[model samples]
Target: MSAPSVPPQSDGGQSGRPGRKPGPISDGVGPTHRAWLEPLRTRFLAGGLTISDLSERSGWAKSKISELLRGAGLYPRWEITHGLLQVLEIPTWPMRRLWMAAALEAHKKPDWIDGCIQKVALTTGPVEPPLEHQAFTDLNRDAYTAYARVFLEDQEAFEAVQETFDLLWLHWHEALASSDVVAFAWPVLRERVMDRAYHSEDGHPELTHAAFNTLALSHLTDDDARFRQIAESLALFRAISRLPAPQLDVMVLTHLLGLDHAAVADVLGTPIAAVHSTDRYARKSLTTVLGPQHDPGDAPA
Candidate 1:
């Protein structure tokens, strides 16, 4: 079935009410909130599962799930969000926050206050100025290493890696909309692609593309080992993408493009001490999300 229609913006005209808001809900916040919620709802429904099915998987009551979906009554607690996220197998905090924000907004209308909410929602967690730079570089390096491990395992697993790359690519675009770090990393990404292609002995463009396709398709595989690896890579990328601007710069320079700490410091006009600190903090933060074992030291330095 086609998805339900979302509210559309109205042309600047009175809709038979004096100074009333133009849409179904006059509150300025409704449209923004609904916009976010509807997409998530559609995604859930598209999974071809019912609320009861979700409840069973998430261990939430069917009624609660329905209420959350309907955007009616009390806001869902983090436990509910966490439970549903577990059932969905979603691993990224940015994705979780995105959904949570949508769910929260569902019950309210957009207003001046929402601006602050959006800012907080989009901002990365606090990082000390000293540790901002190296953290991102380590993150990218770690991500690539993880990606390589997964890609090398099997052609099928390679597809899952590619799928993650596509998600990262899309997410990178989104990050660019809010920050320049992505823009800076684009060429680095291009270089990495070329490097991989050049290093491959097959030299067949189609086969190379197939290899990437293999990684992208990895998300579909049921193999436990491959599934976990792909999930891990995606989660890392998600965390890096959500990093605030300074850390993002470090990530692009150090990880995506493979610059050294000194180079990153020079580029950012920051001290090496600060760079080291940033790297440490970024790594620690990422480890918390990506798991301690997936530390940067574990990846190709």
Candidate 2:
């Protein structure tokens, strides 16, 4: 019998079919695949989940998951890819786009690394701290109020506060990375970086010294009002972070640590008057800085 007839293929160049996968002349596949897969693997490992566990949750086969993780597979099908993301509980929008871009690049010869490579390429070195520290201090105070509100009550108002924080966080990081304070430098410098460090280490003598040094190096010079607000917020965060297990429980439960004035007073062996007064002051201060419109009485703490 005659051999089976084969369909003719088009070759743009003087070579094999144009549409066919290219040979060595085409981009090598290894690096292209690695670019996309490496970050996924890193993130998965960082999440502390096993591949098998991920497979069970995502409803993907072990081999396919492995292949995807290995960058052996470049196709970005939503079913499989999004399933993995759902299992991981990562926000899907940006991550999905990142993966899809990698997959498309991998399909071509001379494949390129993933989007992270481009991001890194665009990034310059570490950014210098902002010149006006007051801006950052103000931002920190705002962030603290927003964060505190979320901690206090699980209400729609708190949800709005959380969304605001999310935007601020992105803006802050961009400012830090780009050294561009005009945009969102205040929040990034004061709240996200400096204030947390100050409070967390303020109680620690060694760390406190280092924190001051960082403040100096970052050139964080601010006005007294802004500085005081940052200091107060840090104190609050520190108090919350260092509360004894019982008091913490009570504060969270009643306020966030739980317990109303009487309950907190009984637990701490303090008078209800003291508990109530302290709570009132804290709430008032928070509201005053966050927004005068916010009601201290309605707040959880």
Candidate 3:
């Protein structure tokens, strides 16, 4: 069967304009949509490609393309989305995951999503992951999993790591060209972890839940001492979570995961000097909140 045709024009003329704004996306799939749409938009704009250009290249109507660009109308099928992605020169494999995630959020069943892929004849035969990509995953997966587990449960943390590797596999070429693979991959891992993290009112990841699981709390046996330690640890963990991203990352690697500054620099793909500076900033920030007596240096150990 042929691919689905464009449905009725839904965006009026608002979307086809040169000065484009993203249109409303379905609430359930909004995050996944932006994950796919934002990169696609950046490439589209960078190439100076028009809806007409995309229509001619991708064989979709300008109206449909506009709606897709603005994220208006129905959650689109993978077939059309894939076509536009090709025209925009976005990597398809990584995007396939994002589209599938959005489709699931939009309540599409796994079998139904698979059927859509089959209908479009888009399935490529199974292939092995690149050796270098596999090597990277093998080396970093455990440490990354440990890092993610600070905020996530085991299964969630494992899935977050798996998703990060899948993304690295998809963009392995671009990642290789980057200054450091860790530098390229770390943010992606963080994004996946944070997506599942419990956020506070101010939008930082909430560590209260994770704080109770810390080894420091687990070792204290006396009820009164445990209670006091819990109070202290909670305050420190909350402060650690609220630090700016760079500082927070350094703190987590250095204190919680037991990585030294040199190791953290390697893991973060940052210079040792920068990691040291960020770690110092994090300590000062924590001290400012919990008092000098409640130094995070004592807690995570």
lDDT of 2 at 147: 33
Q: Write the per-residue lDDT of candidate 1 for residues 46-154, one digit (tens) a residue.
A: 4445566677778888877776666565545556655654554333343444444444455434453344344433223222212433344445543443333422344
C-alpha lDDT of residue 130 in model 1: 22
Query: Model 1: which ten-residue window has the lowest total lDDT?
Result: 1-10
For model 2, how does the per-residue alpha-carbon lDDT over 27-92 read when each residue is reduced to its tens digit? 333322333334345456555566676677788887777766654534545466667655654434
TM-scores for all candidates: the values are: 0.27, 0.27, 0.80
* Of 1 and 3, the candidate ranking higher by lDDT: 3
Report the CA-based lDDT of candidate 1 relative to the real structure. Answer: 0.46
lDDT of each: 0.46, 0.41, 0.75
Best by TM-score: 3
Which ranges in model 3 have alpha carbons more than 4 Å from their true place? 1-30, 123-129
